[model samples]
Target: MAESTTQRTAGSAPKVQLSCEMCRQRKVKCDKLSPCTNCQRLGAVCIPVERARLPRGRFRKSKAAHRVPESDSADATDELKGRMERLEGLICTLMQDNGAAANTIVPAMADAGILPSPCNTESRSDLPWPVGNDVRDGGGLVAQKPSAYLGNSFWEGLMHVQNRPLRNLTDQRHDGATFAPYDILVHGLTGRALLSPLCSTTEPWATPQLQQHLCHVFLSQVDPVFKILHQPSLRAFLIEGKPYLHYDAHRPAPEALRCAVYYTAACSITEDQWPPAIGASRASIIARYQRETEAALVRAEFVTSDDLTVLQAFVLSLIGARSQDRSRRAWTMLSMAVRVAQALSLHVPDPPFLITAFEQEMRRRLWGAIGLLDVQASLDRASEPMILRSWLELHAPLNVSDDDIPFGHEIVPAESDSFTDSTFTLMISKAQCAVRSLTEPGSQYMHIRQACVADFQQTASQLLRNCQPDAVPFHWYTLQVADYIAASMQLIALRPLQRTPDFTPPHVSGSNLLRLSVDILQKTETLHSDPRGHPWRWFEGIFVPWHALAVAIAELCGCEDAALIERYWDTVEGAFERFGGLVADEKEGMLWKPMERLMGRARAKRDTLRVVFTPESASAQSQSPFLPVMTPDQNQHQRGMGLAITPCSSTSGSIGVEPWANVPTVWDEVDFGDVGIDQLSWTNYQDFMEDMQR
Candidate 1:
């Protein structure tokens, strides 16, 4: 019987042993030992198991959940592609048509069966949210429709300007057409001849070579102060004709942006510095590019366009305009730029959409530039700043080089401690906070001045020391701008003291107010007269230091020190010599008359001080303290003569001497500690007031 049982057991399947619960759960092999190999390897406790397992067979069927069909998704994608292709085709067709007005034809075709219709309620289900209402129309990309078009008197107003016939665009000509000036047009209808005498087939106004030169000029001279455009990316685009394809990419900067760069470059340089190969006068080039820039902004519908690049272009145009002169037209344009920036939500530090690191840094830089410009424009108009008081969360851009920001998805590098292209702009950004305090109701000047000094003085020194040799001129310009900012803030702060009934003038020996005023005037003269700073002198018109000049003349009228008066007078005369003709024709040109009268009063003060301090005043004047002045060698190799004295001037006394030689060049530690004004002692206070009234 035992032999028969053994034979049956052998014939049947061998006995199966169960694995431990740990190994069973892990689906790993296990020996029948107490601590299995899998559990020992994992350092887990092996629980002995004797649970029954389900019988192996075909698995039970489970109910399926609802999902979108692949076919439907494919169809939608295909439909979207078809719509895009059709849109491109329509654009090409319109471009080919000679007489077709894009404004009139786009809506007509959209109404007909030719183009894809606007996404309405029924079609909204197929389109994505937020982008469903966004479509290209005649007046550029239409703004998103408000959830409710609320209006006064319970009347529903139009939410979008799309397909609407507006009478005038901001930069449009008197005529209703958005057309480029004849000077900016290069090719002919037949493509065989040029339309304008200045236009050339190889290198016209907007040719790549001219653009390259101007762009280099801008990058070297003006961009360091602003630092908005990415240097490497822009240079690459100029060379390879492909911009960085990423969020908010300009794609070879649109016409408005391109022309803005050109206009600004022309404004920065003098006529002599203009490329001789281009064969165009600087004035003519500036006028043509300026008109074309305005026309391009009109065509882009800058007021309503949502493209960040369009806003950038408009801001740049306004910057150039304000640089040339702070006219009411420029202020009006600045208001438009403010509105556009607000519409783009640039005030918000963090946006709802995903953006690359490079784009984030760029947006911050742009906002910084916009805010700074707005404050400056306000200062020029004597109005409150538009953005400094706002609840903006945007921060200053990092002081990093353009190359530090990666184009790919790699992590962004840390901001550098050394000076970079963005250092000056970052300084401006931080200093603007102090500028905001100047306009507040009960703000303290000392606190603000100290804040600026503590924030910028050391950094400015470090940056100047760290700057590249080739970029010294731009850094010097930045240093001068810093000095001007501090002096101007003090000027703004002290103006009210002049009006107060309890005003007190500083001691006759020396006044920080006078010193600061002289500092401002000296910087202004340097910005306009220095050959190194010629490429950035466009700012001279906007920041003319009229207030500082007035204050310096007033303080000099009460001065007792002959040398101090002479030195201060030298600064005033230098300013007049450099900027007299430019500001003479400006709207504030009437200021020159009172300023000249004040100059006369200051000369009288100088005569009195000379009588008191030293005899033989007339002979001593020739042998002045700052004398033994060296006139520039007439035969020396000279660079472009940009607002500098003519080399062949017959009046040979200190003819070619730098105006700022006696003035303090380093702007590191300016003492704005005791800035005040003297109402009773200021001889031409009434004259200053009269000129202001005029």
Candidate 2:
């Protein structure tokens, strides 16, 4: 029986199943979670399945669910039809408005039209309307639709005038030989050109009559060329396709517009010719000239696309002529010149000339009003301080020659020297004073202040080391260094005082100590490797002695930022390790002998100890009060013991000791006021001390 049942099951066809719409479309197994996989993927609400009830009769199948009502089905079909009809109408309206043909509209609607045909095409054309179309023809397309043009006819007409010649004007009538007053008047009225002659160069020219005649020709003929070129419609047609329209067509090309402005200005000057007649002719010419000039000025001001150099030069000449006038007009002209110069500096290709011109004009105006001091003040306000600082830093090396040694009287003479030197010094002093003044406390400019501080610090340190003591006093150099230090301190203090606790500090940290240490470390490394002997190192003994002094001071002062101090220490320690051997032997008790004696010392019979010291004898004359002395034996012993016990004590406190206890002090007993002990005595003393200590 089991074999027979197996055979029957095997013979039966496999059962096929249909999935829920959600599950089948989603291609996921329908675990039938509250929403099936398909329903979840589709974001559709799933309906739960109900169990089917069995019929009472043997093996009777359950009936299927009932269908929708006939009337409801018919109504649904009718509603769908109505919506489709509305959509078709919308598409037709959009197509018509976009200037699509009726046939095109049908195809679009049949395919996938998104919008109805447009109701009006007047506002949609990218090209100008045909020239002959009537405005009143509502059904017919207008030939010259306003929508087709990007700009008004003014720009287009101007461009045409520039490109085309005047119909009846003769060469002689507007030539360079004789004045054509009538021609000049006509052209000026017609906006062809100004009434002045245009000269290409500043060299001497012909007589006034000839100049006037040339001016008339240029005004009557050449000036119109530029006007036509500036026309919006024409320029637009040239740049964009004939089918494309630009709203700013009248706007001039950057180069061409600039040239046109300059030329127009060139035509306005009344060089050798008499002024325009004072009746209607003059008034009309003046009004037209003013309008064109104003337009050109506006163009120069806002249109960054063009080079304004030539135009600026022309404007500058006009301002120069009227600068002495008492009227506001003169002031206006000067102001315009200033603005043009500034703009040209930024946008024009050749900035040097513009910068020179601006500097000259500004000096002229300022000197006339308030002298050099006020002019300097104005310059301070006008330019970025860093630019000036950078200029000085870059040019300083070039200014100093081999002949200009800091200490020598030849380079830096006494007050009684030649007037030229005095004048030079005075100028430099004045410039420095001006820069410093702008950087003083409460000044609105913080960048200038920072730059000034950095510059002063560098200069003061250099002068202190390289210059002779008699050349510039120690107090003066110290004062400058003190100023920088004070400024640095202020910068740090201001951060905490001026801002809320939540505010972050600016990029320039308040840790002057950290910056100073870093600077010293970098400078030391540079000096050690420098072939020429780092020039700044000449004053190491006079200025801050230890490269690590700044860091040490910072630490002593209880500066909150420890990381900066640690970084500085690391850099200094690294440098010490690298170059320490060159100066002294850390393992031995011997001091560094001069380089000349290195071979002799190496060949010496005894094992010698080396110590690194700055050598007080080399700082200045032996009698100099600033010279440093070797530590006395008793003091050295006490300091070594104290350091071993309390490493931190040396940084904070003093250890009292006598002069002759554990180590020999080389110069302790020598009376060197008149003539210090000989080098042999000092060396013998050191050697004896080392042997005794051992």
Candidate 3:
């Protein structure tokens, strides 16, 4: 017993190791592997103890068994994504709120358009953001400013404005080149307007016939495509006086909306477009209507009153000038509307209790139109779309003509067929909103793969197939024209990336791209304001991209395949003829002038293209007087695309010169001209490179 006790004492020593079950059972020497050598030798079943599986009387960690439910995991992931998107949007708002004074790192960063959809979004987290919607906390900016917040989206946006300049603070040129677009973009976002002297008008706003003419001009001419100002109700207000034309302490008849209509109509043509009863020079009439509108805005407090009519009036006024080179002002004008729209929660879907479905529909129309304006105003930019889809729960306006939906028509009791019929119209608007992300020509928003591109193409085709041009020519054509432009731009994007829209790792076939380009050009037919008469309107939309067309055509004209060139040759000539038609619209005044000037440049470019893209061109190019200009490095980082070589007007620089200087403008050098490397055709690419070598 004394000997056994001594052995137990020795066994209980500090260095004692646990024995394997097989060894312990066999009472033999064993190593601590799962199957001890002794078990293998005995050919017995060996069960090794696992400390991890062993039950502990004490000192075990209190972790619950981790069998995560699929639903729970999915919910967590979705919640996290929602938080991230919200945080991103908040940061974007703060960037705008912080303004030039706060983000001294790059003060003049362009607030290039971003925003939310059809009235209101049920899910704010899913909303796509436009880069420009900076109208300071829902237009209460007059009362307060956006608080500063920092994040990837905000700083990334600021850091990546197309052709933005960055340099040592010590550099003199940096201030001029880098911040030029920034100053312009943020100018209107600041709470207070500088208050300009109100210009006066001479048009007869009280004249019933004149109001009739102007309203007709908007609906017949503009509304089919734009659809901003509600047509049926607006018409009823004029003809039947149903909605009560309410205005504040001003010349009762000369309210903001009326002035806007007058201005837009007057600007739409020279004095000849109107009858003798509405006699006024186009220039003088434009001045008068503009004056009345501005004066009314100054006195008519839309913000304090929270009247959407005033906001609508204000938007209409801006729309009158939408065709102008107001890229800078566009940022402010639309952003102001956005703030008010948000203040009214127009981006959120309305409950039937809060607003009738009709009202909700109208609000959605206004918001969607505003979102489009916000994008177009940014000079046809795809990055930082102003409105997000998630922020709006507003459905698309019914596809039915205005005649179908009377004033205050309720949706709940409506025929389901009418609602179902309007699917195409809704689809078109979705495409328009998606343009900001879809038309991205650079790597800035490339995560959007080919599937999105395919959907856009399919939708465009479907819209075209279902549209009745005779029923609503302007509206139908508007959708048609926009789709064609998107197709053209997509073709451009597909070219340089070589692979499909999905960014698959392969080069796109040049021939498929060529065929697509020719097809887009063929669809780009010109239409006049009157089908067979005077007052010719260019087939222009906010998204009507003349430059992209020009680039695509230039590439096509230079194609190596003789058969393809001959096939699409007339299409190219036709595009030019149509573009040249704008010059005849000299009577349209300043609104048409920017495009007119672009056409003039296109004419010059045409001479170059004829030589470069046609069969009889190589020798001509050798003798060409217009030499290509080259930058030391043709790039600056536009956000996620870090220092990529942008061939669009050479967005790069050398020493002492402002790194961002001489970057083209919408009115000047190039308007939103980043079409990716795809815009550069192989021939043009080679030629441009050769020039660089020279």
Candidate 4:
């Protein structure tokens, strides 16, 4: 028994040591096990160190006078000076190189007509707010105030003037106050003018039952995409009528956010799903909720407010507004929200001592949402993205559900690898980063364009892998949307290639670009037509793929392959028939007239081709899953009209199946420049389209 006990004691010895010797030298926390994390990261062999016995005495304070020798301090100072000198020299060398490069590039750009000449003499208007090096008076103002206006989407004065010594609007103001007469009216005296006269309470549209339903819808459908609000906290606040850390009477951020949620939910509700007890049509409900949201925004003083909740409300309201109207007004409002986010420093993470991990994650999510919205707005109008890549240091939020984050706790749960509440938001952030280069002027270069495509594909594949095949409806829908976004961004990145003269075999490039466009259009068509996509149709309706439709129609006008031509026409006309309402619309002004012309050309091409498909082949083609389904009457009408209805024998993927190098050149008869495609090069397609309309 004594021998057995001795053997058991020897076998029960602890496996862990004090720490690896390297970690001990570096003074980093480490797991005491062999091959510690720090050693592994540094690729060093971990040497285990046993714990040393310490003397049972207090730590002694070192004498300040004897801490260092005078000669050693002098040596340290000399080394520091040498390092500073080297840094200064390197900075000067870089500046000189950059200046020389700019000097060489600018004149070349001017010669190439890429930059405006000095003698162009175009009047450039400055902002109403003062911006200069000397706005201070003789009295010498103590400090400069920050301007609320950050600038247009293309650039911001704040970013420009941050490093420079400059006086802002504060120097001109009487008491260094940033508020103007308009701000006084909007923020102080005229609150009643904008107050909701429809309902006496804060949310008249939100009865308890209705609020529950809307909250459910928003949480399930919209929250997955936005991921701005914390579900548990939001629900608690709603139930208890309590305010968060930044909430106040003057800044009604929570109320505004609530109204915004109600508006978004109402907008997202399908006609069949509308509550009968509301005693109003879904349209009327959306309008009333929208008005309430606007009133709430005014009450919250959103323009001057730097509250996170206010920004969330503003973003949500803009999203709801997009469903109602695809106008520049929403884009302008979105830019204002971007400015507010910048003011709040949402582009950077907060220190651990300053905020809880939960709040930090929330802020990251809000910034991600803003970037996603900016990307959407840019795509909608073909304008420069509001949130530039240079300004963002924010990372995507963790892929965990709200339940994983405990309220008022320091613990941060591990992020899930599979689909979660934040998966869609993370995907959007990735997509935004992928396409950000598209807004840069340098993206016209072949290397940058190719890099953009490569980066986007890599990110997209990673995202798709994270999503499960048989996940929930929204997750599956997000997958399809990912495919759509991938196609759209690739099209944008490759669009500049068509204008380049050095690209060999223009026909192949044109064909590849056309296939990308077709893929985008088909994706759009599928999202709108599918029954599962009905919940997300509000968003789908807003982002109509106008550029893709144009490309497809342009290709079809010259395409000789009967089957491919018909497939192209089927995609184009399906888009047109569904979104034809926009053709007559003056609000969300797209280039419908140019589209009409392209369709005409396609019809003319159809008239020239003989319709010679046998009934048996037609039946087989009709049974093909790739082809668009049409009713008997519709087919008869199209046949009578001599439309190009040929059977497709080729069985390949619907989305750009042919290899890039092997795509036959069919762009011989296409004249994109004549149809205002050239004008789309430097400006928003809609802006050019509007000019053409005028």
RMSD, one per candidate, in order: 23.5, 31.2, 23.6, 25.4
- Candidate 4 lDDT over 248-306, as tens digits, reads 53346777788788889888887887878875678876776776677667667788886
Candidate 4's displacement at residue 622, Å, is 7.2
What is the TM-score of each predicted model, taking all chains together? 0.59, 0.18, 0.50, 0.60
TM-score, ranked from best to worst: 4, 1, 3, 2
**Cα lDDT, all candidates:** 0.56, 0.31, 0.46, 0.58
Question: Of 3 and 4, which scores higher on lDDT?
Answer: 4
Evaluated with TM-score, which candidate comes out highest? 4
Taking the candidates one at a time, how many backbone clashes does each contain?
0, 36, 42, 0
lDDT of 4 at 561: 51
Model 4 spans > 4 angstroms off: 1-206, 239-251, 349-353, 408-413, 496-515, 582-590, 610-694
- Greater TM-score among 2 and 3 belongs to 3
- Scored by lDDT, model 3 comes in at 0.46
lDDT of 3 by residue, 123-216 (tens): 4433333343222110111212333444454555544542343323324422444434322332334322222221112224335566567667
TM-score of 2: 0.18
TM-score of 1: 0.59
CA shift of 132, model 2, Å: 17
- What local lDDT score does residue 108 receive in model 4, on the 0 to 100 scale? 66
**Sort order, lDDT high to low:** 4, 1, 3, 2
Q: Give me the runs in candidate 2 sitting further than 4 Å from their true place.
A: 1-280, 297-303, 310-694
